[model samples]
Target: MSTQMIFDYVIVGAGSAGCVLANRLSAEEQNRVCLLEAGPKDRSPLISIPVGIGELLPGTRYNLHHHTTPQKHLNDRKLFWPRGRTLGGSSSINAMVYIRGNSDDYDAWEAEGNPGWGWKGLLPYFLMSEGNERGTDAHHSGYGPLSVSDLKWKTRSGHAFLRAAESLGHRPNNDFNGSQQNGVGFYQVTQRRGRRCSAATAYLHPVSSRSNLHVRTNSQVARIILRGEKATGVELLDGTKILANKEVILSAGAIQSPQLLMLSGIGDQDQLRKSGVTSQAHLPGVGKNLQDHLDIIQVVEASEAVSFSEALWPKLLTAMRLPELIFLNKGPLTSNVAEAGGFASSSLAGGNPDIQFHMTAVPTFQHGFNKRTCYGYSLHACALRPKSRGEITLDSTDPRKLPRIEPNYLSEPEDLQVMVEAFEMAQDILAQEELSRYKKKSLRPEQKLSDRESIIHYIRQHAESIYHPIGTCRMGSDELAVVDSELKVHGVDGLRVVDASIMPTLISGNTNAPVIAIAEKAAELIMQRSSRSFVKENRHTQEVE
Candidate 1:
């Protein structure tokens, strides 16, 4: 006989969003909530140590490295992508820069038919999640689940870079999450007491002992189990079946959210049939409209000798200073390398910022662990508004197998155009007198800005993802859309996808905080609906653009 203990909500993936949803949904002790993660507990010392994040990759302690099926724009190169498979999802291993994009981004979502997703609509949720070290009621809040604080370990280079950016006529803003996102400044991070404030730390750790919430690690969800047309529960990889009295929420993030959909027979029919997935819901755009921030990173040689390039690895050289950080939680270990970033536009204007910046203090082979030298700054930029879209499809019949992702990165001609423009614009920013004194240019591609074709070629050769993927299981009002405005999966009952995947378009800034806010909003929507009678969301008869 199949054993079953019903839950009010079954939240898959205990990442940043999952943790928040689980915590909030289970707050009503009467409701039964279960949060499952494929990865182990985040006990790795590297995860807490901000600088140690690099080493945490390449090993299972912090990463689940997946790859995209050869990207056409990137010379048919298969991109090696890493997602944090730990308790916090990418937040556990990410640079931890807190951002909410721009007001226009959320407004665009509202414009896209997700009525309550506008920046104004979601600002309170954003404020609620943040516990700003430098607190305020208008700009930030001091009490929140997620700890948003300034780094106690800012380097002279970090300061010099921002000062130089300001001196170069780029406006200096105190906070990116504040009134405006147009200026360069020391980035406020997701930190607590000088250590990395990963979502596992901020959301899960505090609620670990909650009996009302059942947190399961190392349990990968295969798919949402459907009972005829309603989402009844989820089937685990080990063949374990979980029954939910309420809903099965997929918080597996942008990539896996759609992957789960397709696996569970709720996806594009043609793709589903091709993969031998019997269609449960014939949604044509389950994994369509896939978007990610494609970035071109340039490394520079440090004029100053202070860089992690020389001392961060072998685990012993930096291990000597662990006590300084372990007790006080300050020093080299407490710094997430991308200490500074900004949003700006190319001289050629039309929209918000065509270009966005993410700068790291130390450079080691870009993404994962690279004990190699050549450390100064890893300056990165990606076009804020991309016309390109990609998809996530199953590699085989197995859910354990990572999906085929093709961000189709620069598919649209305009994507390359904006990126090239942003590239030249970044060159201009670095050319300023202040930055000129800090370092020498390390990697300059021969593509000059005299013509558009050459610049496109350069971008094609150099561009890689900033790892900001969203819009797979997009939320909109159309036949192709996977979910409705309330984030309920269309054609299915008792199911909701609350993650970056629900974004109809990519935001103009880092996707982390925006994702957190989405989770908070989802919790509100989920719990509120659970308590009251289910009123069918007014179906928008409009089509998706």
Candidate 2:
């Protein structure tokens, strides 16, 4: 708690990867680890309940709740970008959908010269980190920290969506993490016994009593203290300096990790100078190559009152069912809104599906903020991979000030074309007989837009982020690569980044699972370095004698 305090490893950001790193690094009884979080502890009642995502997402204490600069291509709309600011990071506030993305996503990383990062290379770590309720197999493990299970509460609309998807000729696959990721089915959530199982609950909370691990909440890290080229420690916003004797790992998610790097003067020299920060390392790629998934929605009014809209559930009925949810863990309270979905290949897809669908049992108005008064359900389709790129630049020298986020959505002409095709694909599935029985009327894109131009127009007006942002501090062998294959900063020692920001490219699905896996591997790397250091110290002692 003091400025003179020192730690063997000081991890900034108590987020998804940060929680994993804190647990693994402190496992060694002799090693002292310090985990700092800018927000408070994960004690909110909403954070524990699965359906509470709707409340936590808008502007709760758990969310960073950032907004992007107006996009030139998206009719100059400033999209709301919410990142978790709590103990579990986005894992605490996310929809709880568990997806590892495509296997080829990792394989492509290996192709880009990042060895031991391919699907095969990382599968073992994935297996080690997961605790699937379905038991162990080649693709999953039953004894791990994070719990992955089927939804305890199901809606009729979700089942209809899957049936409708099957009618469109897509195969019905139960496991999205299986050998193939091209099918329609329900999503597995990160929950245990109908409650949300965030990274804090999975990893950190279970081990908080360990004497070697120290977790400081509501302590914001201002900047990394670089002694020449090496990151020796970090300074808090209050001017307290805590030294890191061995290493400092940044797990502040995609946005803040790069922003912290830039604040610490590890980014482009020109950019650092302009922001009034003295240059420490001239890495031009600190905030470059930013990527995120963009999605569009199609809402349909339900003919029956089966949907989970606010109007469908009376206040007294919901209050009466509290006993069932508390005792049995089987009720509507356990629902993770986006229940069922699938992956499909668009016209632009090569070997794998390029578009993904997320079908919610409730009607969503502006990311679930403005709830519709009628019963309805919605389906979302997003481009898995986009050609358009963006960047994060400095807004000011103040560490507390948010960075300027420019996703540059639809900057690439081909991206808009793919969106048009995805829109049409989503429309086809909603019109199938399985779902048509419940459909009363189409609520969005009011009239069916058949022409490509009209489809594009509809997209620009309604499209928004699916909340997966990555690639700012990319890892590669290219000139702009910020980190190497080992996740170590290319130009600095005693420092590494272990979050989504280090991704060379965005993965094909939800990012939480992959981020946890990445930290599992990083923990091993850090322990390996500790082993070698201990051996060298012993050898030096023998030479002196």
Candidate 3:
């Protein structure tokens, strides 16, 4: 093993949160920050292109490609959970939808005993992180690190999807993140000049020249090294120890943050003993309270060849647009497949929209891995808040081994009812007159939707995660909470978790934008704490002298 190196701050997982933390913490020259990423740099051309998600989502090159243990509620099938492992993390592989979720979602967090996490407290951070192309407004800003923009190009089917939703009295909303979030509209994306603006692209790359900021890729953290109840540093898989004089932050997202904590012997004492690991903090919530958005897709064959598909003609057409994408930064290739969608309340929901939609201008089979021969479009609907909760447990003590994930989807009967309502709503939108021009026939659910039992069965068989996993390392003052409102791990010092994993509950929409906003707020909290500590240390030194 090499000699131990020390730094003021060490951030594991150079993902969305890690990149933001690195940039903000290292802004002060006195603070030495080291960022470690398990994956390679985010330099692939495919990662820059919006359409490259088709290739990136299904492959293991830039993805962790984690799978859940067989779900009992869903016919004992294992669901694929692909998370980004590269420098940018999931932002490099996500669909780039810029959604902050419902404002009430944040308010609910505050209601649950978490102060300063409500919509009002978090809005400033969101504004500080966004550089929207549409300019500044009450809820947006034009001067931030991340660039949010309208799509340079969109599929004709996407427009039709919006019109269809409006035709059904869903309302036509141009901005989902504006004064209202309940309407059909085009989703602004995390893009800059038609290119994917991942967190690394927005925050990390800009400040990479800072002398105090050290970034190391392809370095996997084995476990956090603790002394008593305090985190002193981290041990990498290669047997190298990097001490953190100030703090060690985990930005490894929902799946891995708790796994790391457990692997480091900070979870339930009994569970750790079962894995043959010594117990440290004995926080049983380290890997419990797992929550995710389960999505069901409805595919319809298009009467016209307007959808982007793997069919011969569409493939050739996409290729022909490459020149336009390269030169003008505008073309079909610039389209984030899930171009337009809306938020609506299910019949069972109260006040806020309980169901969200994502309209894709292509037929996706098995999470876009299988190439479809037909030209079609798809509509995805998911319940915003699922009552069913799950957990993540260790398979062994080895850090290299992935934890056993059990989302336990559809275990709650209320969740199933909401999904059933969402499915019918999707069917209603597709049947509208606005979409009749493009719709040929319903291709999925292969069973008659007239019967409720059939709809329920289809949902169980087809429902998949929309890639939003959260709450494994939840934030709250409750006993099950792994972190507090300031994001510090419970019962442990010199350690914090800043990622989607800290969300007490999953928000009502896409998680990427909210995760960025969380990091922005976390940066402020960390800086304030550091400043106070410095003052206290200086005062003590002067008194002693």
Q: Find the candidate with the highest lDDT and give its number.
A: 3
In model 1, the runs with Cα more than 4 Å from the true position are 1-5, 311-317, 347-351, 444-454, 529-545
User: How well does each candidate superpose onto the true structure, as a TM-score?
Assistant: 0.92, 0.95, 0.96
For model 3, where is the 10-residue window of minimal lDDT? Answer: 530-539
Question: What C-alpha lDDT does candidate 2 achieve relative to the native structure?
Answer: 0.88
Q: Which residue pairs in model 1 clash with each other? A: none
RMSD versus native structure for model 3: 5.3
Residue pairs whose backbone atoms clash in candidate 2: none
Instruction: Candidate 2: list runs displaced more than 4 Å.
Output: 312-316, 529-545
Give residue 134's lDDT in candidate 2 (0 to 100): 97
lDDT for each candidate structure: 0.79, 0.88, 0.90
Candidate 2 lDDT by residue in tens digits, 1-545 = 55667999999999999999999899889899999999999999799888888778786588887889999988999998999998998999999999999988999999999998999877877776788999888888777789999998888999888888888888998999988899999999999988999999999999999999999999899999998889999999888887899999999978999999999999999989988988889999989999999999999989896667676455346546767778998688888989999898877888988899999887787876787877788889999899899999999889889999999999998788778888998998988999989988899967678888888888999999999999999988788999888899988999999999988888989999999999988888888743334334434543575
lDDT of 3 by residue, 1-545 (tens): 47688999999998899999998899889999999999999989889999988889998879998899998888888999999999999999999999999899999999999999999988877877888989878878776779999999988898888888988899988888998889999999999999999999999998999999999999999999999989999999988999999999999999999999999999899999998888999898889999999999999888887778777887888978898988998998888899999999988788889999999989888997887888889999999999999999999788889999999999999999999999999988888888868877778955348779888888889899999999999999988999999999999999999999999888999999999989988987988744334334434543575
